[model samples]
Structures are given as C-alpha cells and as structure tokens.
Target chain A: MIRLKVALAMAAGIAAISSAPAFAAKAKSEEKADAAPIAIPAPPPGKGQIVFFRPGGMGFALGCSVNENGEKISSLGAGRYFILVTEPGTHQYSVKSEAKDTLGLLVESDETQFAKCKIKMGIVAGRPDIQPATEEEFRKQKSLKLVDEDDMGPAPGALRPAEIAAALAQAPAAE
Target chain B: MLAIFVATILSAAAVEAAAPESDGVSSADATEMVLSASLPEGGKAPLSDDPESARRDITIPKLTPISIQILKPLGSKLSKTGETFPIRLAAPILVNGVEAVPAGTEGMGEVIHAKKSGGMGAAGELVVTARYLDVDGRQLPLRSLHWAQSGQSRVDTVNTLNVASAASPLPIGLVGFFIGGGQINVAEGALADAKTAADFSIALPQVSSQQAGTGQELSEGDLAVPSGAVPDEAVDTESAAADVHQGGKE
Candidate 1:
C-alpha cells in the first residue's frame, strides 16, 4: 500500500511540474485582460482633439519629445499614444529625436486629428517624424493599448492651459 | 528484502540510461556548467575576438562612393585653395542594393590645391576634394578628389557673347559682361557644377555598442578614416584634367 502511495505522489509531482508553465502563461493573459482600455475624452467647447501616436519602430525604446506651438506636451515612446485637446487654431507640432521634425496643422472645431509618428534611421541613432494620419490608418490603431501616464514623463506636466500660456510667453518668436 | 532492493536499483539504472544524450554532457550537467561559468564571469561570458564574431558584432556596411557633379564651376581665377564649396550628387548612393542617399543631395567640397593662372601659361591647377555629404540632415563624411584645369569652366561664353552683342549699343554693360565672363559671381556661398575626380567609397564607422542607447549623437571620432587605405580606382585624374583643359581652351 505504501509503495503504491509513493508512486502516485511521484506522478502527481511530475504532472504539477509540467503544468506550471501553462499556469504562468494563463496568469499573464489574465493580467493583460485586466488592463484598462483606452478611453477617448470628449473635447471641450470650441476645442478639438489632437492625437499623436507611434505605431512601431526599429528602436522601440527610444522616446521622442513632442512639442505643440513650442511648448512640450509629451515624450512618446514607440507603440504609444498621447492625446491633447486644444482650442481650434493653427498649431505647430514638433518631434525632437536626433533632430527636430515639425508639422503645422489647422485644427478645426469639433474634429479629431491624428498624427502618425514613425522612427527612421539617422546617422547617429533614430529620428522621429510626425505626419498626418488617414482615417483608415487611425482606425487600425484603435485596438492598441494607450501609453501609461507614468511613462509620459515631465513634459506632460506642462500640458495645462496656463502652463502653455506661460511657456509661450517665454518662448522666442519663430524665425 | 535483497530482491526488492536489487529491483529498485535496476529500475533506477534503466531510467538513467533512458535519459536523452546531450552531445557529451547531460542536459542537467550542461545547465549547471553554464550557470557556474556565468556566475564567475559576472553573468556574461567575455566575447570572443575571432574574426567571424567581430564581423558579426561590429561590421558596418561599406557605402558606395557617390558620384558628385559640381553645380558651381570651380576656376583657378575665382576659386582659392582651402575654399569650401557646395556640390550635388550625380547619382544616388546605394548600400547592399538599397538606396541610402538620393541623387541631388547637397555635398561640401574643399579646394585642397589651387594655383591661379600665372604668366607663362602654367596651366592653372585646381584640385578639389569632397569632404562630406549632407544626408537626411546628417553630415556623412565622403572622400573623393577632383583635379581640373581652367578649361572646364562651365561659363556660357556663347550666352555672354550674345549679351555682349545685344549690349554693344550700351558700351558700359558690354565691359561688365566681359569682366565677369568665366568667373562664378553669384554670391559668397553658391553651388557650382563640377566633375568628380575619382570614385570614392564612403567608409562609415561601425556604430558603437554603447551608442545603442536612446538619443545618442554620432560623434566626430566615429568618422575617422582607417590608416593605410588604398584609394578607389574610379578616380581618373587624366580625364578630369583633359576635360578642364578642353573647357579652358573654349
């Protein structure tokens, strides 16, 4: 009887060892499922939404600083997105990686604009470029997870309307 | 009791023998050896200095020397030694069959050697060497030497003649055209078309492993050329001189 019991215990241990990896994978999937979905906030009166997103890059870890009208709004990493609600006007957006790439947009009221950011090989490392995103391209990225607030860095801290005004006041005129 | 003990020993031996062979060392033994080796070496083995490993790790693709045509013509009378001028690539630069730099990319060249036309017809010598190419907002070092005589001047003598004939009624304007003839006089900084002296191979330095981090800029040290390198054969100083002589005679 004791010999049979020992054999059963050994078999049980082997089975447990084999199933451990599957259990760990299940746990990871559960954690991913628990992550909150990205929510798009409604634009304020007379303001529109400007979304800057990087779908992918060769150097995925490189973060680029994104500035709106000379005021930095966020540092976006590859496969991450940042949304800003701003008053309708022409805003100058710049992405600074190895060099600065700027784009000007005439934002209209009650409309959402999407900018797709891509990383290109530079002489040193990688450079970031911001281009207008088509509706189809923007729709394809809807399922992507939004970047976490912690990874947004100190640039996002200056996104307030008063802070933007203060920064613009101190900024030199564009030559 | 002895029979049971022998049976147990036989079963254990059979199980051990059934374990799969892993080359020479058993799987467990190999794992243990790797772990121990890693621990003593600070969790990473020293990289091998073999040629294959070095090539795999640090090999940078050789950039084909681009053909540059001078936009602003260089002349001994106007161009001085050590003067920097702008140039344009005649053809795109390809690396591993992919276009790395497009045609018409602006480049900068330095007048390495120049001698103005002196009395006795010394055949004014001008040797210009390409310094670097402005690619995608980055300055990539390029090396090519072009030698020319005053004959290759792109100055449209016919056009000047036409202007001179048209302005003959105005003697003051005719003198201005004659004086400015065969001279590049747009401004201090201008691009003139010139010919490439030799085919140059662009040698980009290997990207350092440390610079793999985010936001690293290419430093000057990365562009140092290797010593004792042979020049590319595509340079035809004879042809360049002949073209210049032919232009000077015109």
Candidate 2:
C-alpha cells in the first residue's frame, strides 16, 4: 500500500511538471489575443492618403509636432501614426523641434503615401526626421498605434473661423 | 518512502517553475493574439491595403551615372540658405546602361549657402546641394554631393569686359560691353541650364547572398570598385587610367 501511494504521488508530480509549460504558453497567447484592434481610415474619394508613422524609438515618451503648410496637424508620439487626407497636389510637410526638417511631397490623386518619422539627438532634446517610407517598411512596424483624439494637441496659434475659412478656400479642390 | 515522494514532488515543482516562458514572439503576432480572441468567430480584422505594385515597365539598370539638370535655377534673388527647390534630369539616367529616371523626372535640391551681390565688386555666391532623385515614384535620397557656382564667374567676366571696353576707342564698344554685362547678370539662370556640371554616380550594394563564392568579400579597409563606373565611351583617358590603377590594387 505504501509503494502504491508513493507511485501515485510521483506520477502526479510528473504530470504537473509536464503540463506547466503548456499552460503558461496558453496564458501568454491569450494575453496577446486580448490586445485592442487598430482601425485604419480610408482615403476620401479623389483625395490622397498620407500616413505619418513613427515606429521604434529609443525615446519612447518623446513627441514632436507635425505641421502641414504651417498649420499644426498633430503631435506624433513614438510608435504612433497619424493619417491625413487631402486633395492631390504639392504639400509641404514639416516636423518641428529644436530645428525644423521639411519634406516636399507631390501627392497624386487616389494614391496612398507613407512617411516614417524618426527621432535623433538634438542640442536640447530629440529632433524629428520625416522621410518617405515604402509600403513594406510601414507594414513591418507591428506595434504602431493610431493617435487618439484626446492625445492630439490643438493647432498652434489657433486660427480664427475666418482664417480657417480663407485657408480652406485657398486649398485646391478635391476630386 | 514518504520523504522520497515529497522530494520527487518538490523537484517536479522546481522544473515547472524553471521552464522558459514565451517571451520572444513578434509584436504583430502578439497584437493579433490579443485582439483575435475578442473578434467574432470567423470574423477577421482588415489590414491596410498593400501599396500598388511598382510599375514593371521601367527596368532598373545595373550601375550608371545619372545626369541631372537644374530646372528651377538657384540664385541670390530667389534662393536663400537652407531653402529647398526643384530640379529635373537633363537626360534620362541609365542604370546598367538602361534608362532608370526618365528625362524631366522631378528631383529636389537645397541651397546650402547664398549671398546677394555686396558692394565693392563683391560677387553674389550660391552653393546648392542635391537632395533626392524622384525615380519612378520613389524618392531616392542622394548619397553623393554636387555643387555649382554662378555669380562669381559672371562677375569676373563683367570686370574683364569693362576694362577691355575702357581701353577701346569706339563708343559702340562700351555700349556692347554693358549689354554683355547685362547678359552676364542673366547668366546665373543660363549657366545652370546650359552647363552639364553635375553628375551622380551611385554604387549599388552587392546582395550578400549573391556575393557568396565570388571571392569579392570586402573587409572594412578594402576599397571596392564603384558599381556605377561611367562607361568607357563616357570616361576620359585620365579617369580610365585611375580606374585601372584602383582595380589593380583591389
């Protein structure tokens, strides 16, 4: 009877040892499956879509303001993306920090453009660099989250209603 | 016996605790795993549409010097330091002897330095840098440097003509000289348009897998041949000789 009891206990221990890894793996996988889904917005008809995304960054908490034609679009954080839909034409994109770096993009109608933002060491803090990104490059960044509305900063030097109307009036017509 | 059984149970518990956890999974998979369980059964989240396939009509040449032209002329009046401007290829850029960037394909240039004409015969100065070549919908950041001067040469030529006219007997000579000087003033735009002073020869990196067994493995100190060596027809004798010397050393 003593021998039988010992055997049962040993068998129970072996079973527990064998099953632990499997349980742990399942739990981890379950944790991952619980992450929130990202929603990507579609480009409006006859307009182009520009996605400004920052992938991996050493300074994860650092952020910089992005401006389009001198109007502040959003403050982009690390591992985040912002989307802008505009009429296809020439657009000046700039990232503002200790100094500003600018890129001239000729947006084509009905096309999607991807720009990657990176942070570099600056005199005061990190400066942002925006560059054209290939589709494959953008897709490979798996952790890129969409910037939420609350996280977006208000447009700098907030334009009055008339100024906003004038600016929109001057903008090219969307197809 | 009970003591042995207890020891066995403890050993098993230790082994279970020591087993490695799943820590190295890709972020994409992890994200999918987190969201997938909440998704309705058999329903899938949408992915961003893939970019349009690169136009296959244009073939990439192996290695060739790309010739570009300044479309929008840079001068003291129009360009300021750190200002960006547009440019175009004067001729189609060939890669491996094939057309890569067609003529008139838009490119970007920057004025690194610019100064308007100061008093005391001080000529205007301008230094321009090429930024990128927009090739077939791709903006390839330039890895090479190209610079050109305009105002100084025009200034020198004007001074030479003025001195020559002053020494001449005819009044018509002075009038002609002034007109020529005016032409020189306009020459800033013309020089950039007419002169073929800038050429970019880029070296394409050899794919590591393709380089296997080629005896072309290069170390940090080894200077490899420029992939975009100008064709023999295009290179002068001196340049060809230099290439030969470099090749021999390699």
Candidate 2 chain A: minimum summed lDDT over ten consecutive residues — where?
A155-164
Best by TM-score: 2
Stretches of candidate 2 off by over 4 Å are A1-42, A153-175, B1-250
lDDT, candidate 1, A1-175, per-residue tens: 9999999999999999999999999988877775434344445446766777877635576777777666767777767776776776556678887777665554545556676666544446556656555444555653454556665535443234444345346643111
Q: Judge candidate 1 at residue B23 and give its lDDT.
A: 52
What lDDT does the true structure give each of the candidates? 0.51, 0.51
Given candidate 1, what's the lDDT at residue B52? 29
TM-score of chain A of 2: 0.67
Candidate 1 docking class? incorrect
- When summed lDDT is taken over every stretch of 10 residues in candidate 1 chain B, the lowest stretch is B223-232
| Clash tally for model 2 | 12
